[model samples]
Target: MTLRSTGRWFWASDAEGDRGGPSGRRGGALAMMVVFAAVMGCAGAFAAYRALTGDVDAYLASHRQITAQVLSLGDRTSAAARRAGTSAEVAWVDGSGIGHTGMTRLRGDQVEKARVRIWVDADARPAAPPMGGSGVVLGSLITGLVAGAAGWSVALLARSGRRAWTARRAMAGWDREWRAHADADS
Candidate 1:
């Protein structure tokens, strides 16, 4: 078998040209599959990045950081709580001077009546901080990788099935030809 590269694609042929035979078709299908996977992966990454960025922007626009006074503290029975902080009840005023109270986690050293900065949404309810750039980038990369892998795996499986079916058919044909030849000789 001889392999040739045509700038962007590589294909194989025997002593004679592939001439649209199974090998040539397989080479073409492989190239197409790679292109399809790349397109899908890039599209998935871009979509994820855009969606995450929009969400961050919305959060920044609708949320604000304000100073709150710790009203009380809750118990932390475990040394390894998912939240390694002191649970405290805090009260703050929104942009419109409307007062609200809620429970939130603070540093372990927090004490009652201590002022702390916390994030609050439009409804003056405590909320988590907006996603950072690194988190968004990581999420996008993971999504792209998953998309590409899934597309490539599915295509490879289909190609393998087609190859198996073609080989079976070819073997059956060869058996039929051999039987016909023996009958003629009889």
Candidate 2:
């Protein structure tokens, strides 16, 4: 949907070389890539916004620190490499004096009755730590950069392919012309 009046073409809808020529195909592909990059960047912006605003972190933090009693130990074999803790079933009393139970990580070799600090959400459900502001910023930055780079790469590849195709077509036309004139000089 780019304006071609100014002679600046991003993507060409016609790559078949029969209509708008190879330039059209390359431009059309590039335009699509730009659209994709924009969409990805917008999505990343929304994610960053969500991470920046609201009480997502504060609410979780206010209710996060707690001591829980280990009810049962979990196996560590399935955990990732260098995972410091093993999963365990735990129960703890919230600030409201209400009892809640969940599965959480505990130091390896921790036996039953051992207590550990755990983080819980507003619904008293075990949850991961909230993303901090810096983390959000970093994530959004990386997302935008990656998206832009992807778009550029796509455009570059399409442009090269289009140029090569055009060159081959030009050479073929020249070969046919030369053949037609070859007998004239004989």
Candidate 3:
């Protein structure tokens, strides 16, 4: 079989003459701009969505409870009865009026202890705010706009490149054929 039949001659001829042909530099630049714009639009949309749907108050309340628990755990120490012995256990009622237990073990002067309790204010509101829906709407808008811009840019670049390539190829082919005819005539 001939090499051409096997697709081995695909790069044998430089269809685009010297100087890298049309360069396609503008097309590449346009494509990059479109991609950058799309990414920015997506990011803006995501931020808007979070702003609209995220519940700031509920988040703060949960964080406050967690902080109080951490503080209580740090301040409350083992009772005197437990401190005297090699192993000690203590029980205390937390702010929530729930009884909780903690145990400490002293091994060669090193003390280790663990405590468990639940902390959640009875009057606290819901953990999350109601969804606003606006954020998602805004995000969708931004995404659509950006995507459209990017697609438009890419399409324009491709169209221009195709036209340029067609013109260049036509000229080159005509020149080659004319040269062959002239040589034959001679």
Candidate 4:
């Protein structure tokens, strides 16, 4: 058997069998594009959801005031500050002609204050529970996956193109070699 047939190199003649064949390459490209599109779509949707359901001014006001208070205390680094409870007195009017005094703890610092703000409701219950580290972890994972996939897809396309080009060049060299041999015999 000829080297081409024995080694299954005949497939080289059929462009469809090439790694960068139109259908296969298009499928790979389309899959990569879909993944990119999905990531972008999710990011946009998340932004819109936050805009619609979240109160940006309220969040900013809460953070600014609480952060200032924490910074002013200068007890940010002390572990004791975390355990110690500093109180603020608040006054409110009741049903009768009586006023009331309520004490709220300073908590730790800005980081703690932000955590409380997200987790606790007006009633002081854990209403909007914080996602905590999970959100960060998930975001990192998604970002890494998308970036890796994009890089890999681009590399695959480049490699496939190079392979197809190399195979065509080799076939041309083989044709030239056969022609030279036939001329020598004549």
Scored by lDDT, the top model is 1
Model 4: per-residue lDDT, tens digit, 37-79?
A: 5665566545544543355445433332211112123344556
Greater lDDT among 2 and 3 belongs to 2
The candidate 4 region of ten consecutive residues with least summed lDDT is 64-73
- The count of residue-pair clashes in candidate 2 stands at 6
Which structure is stronger by TM-score: 2 or 4?
2
Which wins on lDDT, candidate 1 or candidate 2? 1
Candidate 1 lowest-lDDT run of ten: 1-10
Question: How well does candidate 4 match the true structure in TM-score terms?
Answer: 0.32
Give TM-scores for every candidate, taking all chains together and pairing residue i with residue i.
0.69, 0.47, 0.34, 0.32
The collision pairs in model 4 are none
Ranking by lDDT: 1, 2, 4, 3
The TM-score measured for candidate 1 stands at: 0.69
Superior by TM-score: candidate 2 or candidate 3: 2
On TM-score, the candidate that comes out on top is 1
Q: Where in model 4 is the C-alpha error above 4 Å?
A: 1-132
lDDT of 3 by residue, 1-186 (tens): 122121211222224433223554445555666776677667656665566445544544453332111111221245643455344344545457866444433323322333323223434321222334565586667765766576666666765676576666656666676777789789
Per-residue lDDT tens digits of candidate 2, residues 1-186?
A: 222221222123243454454345545655777887777677766766675655565665566677889898876676561276787899999888999999876665778998877778778887665667777777778877776677667667876786676566656666665766776667
